[model samples]
Target chain A: MTGSEVKKLFYMENKKGVLGKLKDGLLKTRRNLTERIEGVFGGRIDAQALEDMEEILITSDLGVKASKEIIGIIERTDPVNLRETLKGEIFNILKKGEASLLTNGHKPAVIMVVGVNGNGKTTTIGKLAKRFKDEGKEVLLVAGDTFRAAAIEQLSVWGERVGVKVVKHKSGADPGAVVFDAIQSEKAKGADVVIVDTAGRLHTKAPLMEELKKIKRVMDKELPGAPHEVLLVIDASTGQNAIEQARIFHEAIGVTGIVLTKLDGTAKGGIIIAIIRELEIPVKMIGIGEKIDDLRDFNAEEFTEALFE
Target chain B: MFEGLTNKLEGIFRKLRGRGILKEEDVLSALKEIRLALLEADVNFKVVKDFVERIKGRAIGQEILQSLTPGQQVIKVVHEELTSLMGESYKKTHLSPNPPTVLMLVGLQGSGKTTTAGKLANLFKKEGRQPLLVAADTQRPAAIEQLSLLSSQIGVNFYGTKDGDNPIRVCEDATHKAKREGFEPVIIDTAGRLHIDDALMDELKMVREKILPHEILLVADAMTGQDAVNIAQRFDEALNLTGIILTKMDGDARGGAAISMMAVTGKPIKLIGVGEKLDLLEPFHPNRMASRILGMGDVLSIIEKAEASIEKEEALRLEKKLGTDSFTLEDFRGQLKQMKKMGPLSQILDLIPGLGKFRSEINIDDRELIKVEAIIDSMTKKERGNYAIINGNRRKRIALGSGTMVTDVNRVLKQFIQVKKMMKAFSRRPMGGKGGLNIAREVMKWQ
Candidate 1:
């Protein structure tokens, strides 16, 4: 699509109720103020123009801290080129804290997917396995979610489609034992990466969480530093609640990075900005569609621009 | 918002509320309520099973039973477990140190991708960042136009050619433009298909390769319920998503999507769209959200909104008056005005913990509020401060002047008297200490 066409897509009117209305209002106000400021300045920066810009920023839902920092930079910078300078300052703040995707230099980087039930943990692992397999890496799937009968079968189905080997036990088996076996099998087969899928349980369930922790411990013991990446999968559709989910998972088991799934669904994608603003955790990847290749590495600047667009 | 769950919980808790200790059966009954609520909310069945088991384990423990207030202790346990079930800490998005950090927007058709892109850009623009918008969704009719319009609306720079082109190419070019133009953040809006189609996957892969975005955000609609979780799984498998944004939370959705989606998909929900407006977006907070879902009003959030809307000194002054039972109709009008400032009455009502169940029953229509305001407007300044002066004749006159019926005015007066009496009794109650006055003070300060 042409850049203009892409921009048009980004600007589509959100029909959903209050959220849509709020977004439209903020954008409209910002646009009007920006135009007014630009008209007044005529490409020249002035103190009044700076103040107007600050109001615009504050109105755009940028938190007070970030807005103040931006304003501070604009106040301190050369007035003649204030707008660009302010933009540059805000960009710097957004770019400050970012985490990279999992890359352990091992023959097969072991990424053990962790998350509660219905957070798309199993499917994400399946997709990750497929992505690695498509990249010509020897990938193995281990169904550690022994609690659910369908979960193991689900991973097995994905494993077959992705042309990867899946290791699983019967229903009601030990998840830790399953991971241990999968790792041993992968090592024996000289696999490039081993992706383990564990049972989905609430982070609140201490015993279940303990079980997951135990599984991680066993995986590490079997293959030292084996579960190199504990990618916490979260559903993007949960809106602000996703932040809470991230917190619980991180506390129960250290989450190295996050895999945000289902971005293609809601206008609340702006929550990512809030997450970054509040938690400062780096998002490793995002899922936009239900395809093996939909998982892509996260880019904050691109995300910010797409959101505004 | 959480009225359904809260009502179920309250019914179960009512039996245990007055009791000093909660027996195993009492905990079991509450768990049953939780179980039903979870199921109704479309939480994954397996997750619910494990959750109930965990809660049961803690509830049956000797420590809880031996507590001074076992019922409250059990409730606290449930609340804490629920909060933990979500997540304990806020996870921030990972921003790259490099300039032109790419963020890709992805979602299924009708998922509000374009709108979310605009909201995100506006968010960054508020941060004073020069964000470049990339229209990468080429297949959908008017997709690029939609994005362009949003970018202009948000006053952000748009990057994309007019000619029909591949989305990946547009992203590549947009990245180049962002770099050349010195834009620090670049947002790419990608195409989405009805289901997980191969063509769409290939296009997303191409775009990912071209842009190598710093963050890949998946936008999902909360109204889709369990399907949202499945869709998220598919997307995560394909794109290795970095974060998630749930849209359309302002609707009548039971918020099952929020719970089930999170349980099924491990991606952190970065933001929530409470309304369609650019400013309606808010950062996800688990504790507040848990309380919201439990049918417990988020007092802190309510206070924050109130603080934002009203002067702190005025709020404090009003609080003091409420404490002494000196709150008058003038204060009532002020409170009404404050409620108006917060949002629509119905919307505010939804935020009340247990009141959600009666939302439909209690028609807090704006028209009714307007009628009340009109009646209050007709009152003399003296009568407003001292409602005792509002005699029957004056009530009829005020009703006529306000364009409301005498019955409506009488109803308002009666309700007012009840409120006054309740406030007086509340102030005199010895327990009206810190906790007792909290709800009453909040209600009085609503304006």
Candidate 2:
């Protein structure tokens, strides 16, 4: 859907008093901008008007750097169609950051999922596994989050639903060891894909983070260039703080991409702009709902459109 | 004053102080503290990991400052960066140019949607706008009744269909009523599901189709931690929310929802429900909140308030006297009167950067200020300006006049001297060109 379509969706009128107030607020900002632009064009659109527009963007939580960049472009291009120009700029910002899920050249492509606990890392793994299996790839699920209770059971249940084999050890066992075994089994069984789930540890714990590094090292040793994707699962509801979490995880262990879970909840999903602007990391997938099928591949155009809509 | 977080921060800072600058080890240590704090505050673990990595990249290879303490500098940087990470501006709810602006509140059950509706109405009412409240949450038992009671208490008009009418119909009817009655703003409190159920989503979609709300605000409970983020994402996908209203912030909720929800849902946090009181609602200010979490008093904000509320000539005179060590009880009384113009002392304290955690503990009472004033009022003008004039007989007479014992007067005098001494010391210290002494200077000037 186009951003204009999403914008139109928000403009629909209802009797709900709370929704009406909120709609008025959003529309008022947009209307104020339109009026200001009209006024600027009627007279002389000077640097001060441009500055005012920049302030408006920044105040809207577009961040200072991004707002400056947008203003710079507007000043340079002097586009006649402000709305289209703004939409194009927003679309480009989102487009530059896209996370690709597919990988080639490695049979039974190994993907290691790492994140802090309760970030839906295991569930994301299950959903991804199901996605691959439904695409006709023989997938193997490894319950590497062995530190937490019921984690193995949780993955086992997902494996059963997805019709995939799960390799797991007792709780408190080495997560790295489980990944090592899962990869070996995948090769022997000729599985099309191998997804490893690692224990959720705070990035603050040096020892735990060191363990994740070791796990990646061991996986690479067993299968050259194995664990091709180190997807960092971040909760979408974290607003701008999620950017901080993403940066920390990327520094500790190179995060190939991001899985932004819980996109269904917050209005601050606009924070995706801030995250992409700062980290330059691709958002591979988004979890819009709890169902397995709800994990949709990140589409910048679609997401941007959803925001305006 | 944030006993729990302060101890954790102290541990982390102690380890980092020895390292000089923020190194990988320091980052690790600090992350550990932050991780524990976020978890204790009920933040999702995955979110914490990503958060730590971001801090690490910015912290490493940094030069250690020798003049200022390393711990203090690191804390300052961390706090500043965290605030920036959460978006630097305070986002206000969008208002349409056209009258009868629609705002829809969505969330799961027990997310405090009803209370938030009342709070939003109260906020608009304070701005002199007439807001109509609509009870669209027909699923939950007594949801409509609760909204009715809150609306009555807040003095806002409420519309709801009795006998179990459809929520969509209720919203449509309410909007028509609001337009007819010339209400400027309309707030709708919708039904919340226990989870992201299809039935709930479909019902919300129907309401959206019927009303076409300008903004869909998800009312989320901060205490739910990571689950709050998940629920927000669901509602955003189903309803396409315009913003978020975080509730139950008055509790020890670590505020993970504020961070996670913004990151996940890409929505701005429009308002926060700090207390159950209708007037306790505050617009979400990222910088102020960041400083509060870091334990630094928000002196800048307080100064801003003082600038707005305190008379310019009075403030300048007080500033001059404070700088010259000529401040006295007379100045103190003037400051107290000025503070009254700003609003409640408790509310002012809560705005201070690092003082949010200690807001409950801070003794800010009008009665206490009144007592202090009475004591000052009983003293002769000469005694008020130069506290040294009050001898034993004079002190006894002043105390009796103020309805207090001599000992209480003596205690006040002793505390005033200590405060004056502290100000003297603070003025001598370099403020690092950042107006660090603003709060102290302002307080002393008031005295």
DockQ of each: 0.03, 0.02
Lowest lDDT sum, 10 consecutive residues, model 1 chain B, at: B431-440
Instruction: List the candidate 1 regions with Cα displacement exceeding 4 Å.
Output: A1-309, B18-26, B66-68, B93-95, B127-130, B152-154, B159-164, B182-184, B311-341, B353-360, B367-447
**How accurate locally is residue A113 in candidate 2, as Cα lDDT from 0 to 100?**
93
What are the candidates' interface root-mean-square deviations? 16.3, 15.1
Docking class of 1: incorrect
The sequence of per-residue lDDT tens digits that candidate 2 reaches over residues A1-309 is 232432343234334443333333234334444565555445434776775665445333354456677878777765466556766787887897786875566787889898764457877887898789878988888888876445687688678757888898987798888888877763425887889988765453455677888999888998888778889887554433455467777897788888877555432344456668888888888765455565777778766544444
Candidate 2 residue B16 Cα shift, in angstroms, is: 2.9
User: What lDDT tens digits, residue by residue, belong to model 2 across residues B208-313?
Assistant: 9988999899887654544555677778888888888887665443565577677777778878876556776767777866766666556666666566567777
The reply for model 2, stretches above 4 Å from the true place, is: A1-309, B1-11, B14-23, B57-81, B138-155, B161-163, B307-347, B350-367, B370-406, B409-447
Provide TM-scores for the models.
Answer: 0.50, 0.48
Q: Give the alpha carbon lDDT tens digit for every residue of B1-447 in model 1.
A: 445566666666667778986788878878987876665554544566678998899989997889888877777777777777766545675657888899998877556677777888887888888888888776544457667777887899987654357777778888888888898688888775634456667678777776788888887766453345556777777878887787766544456556655666677777877664566666677777777776577666655565555655665565567645467888777666766666555555666655645554654445566788899998998888888888889989999999988888887777667666665665565432232224334443333
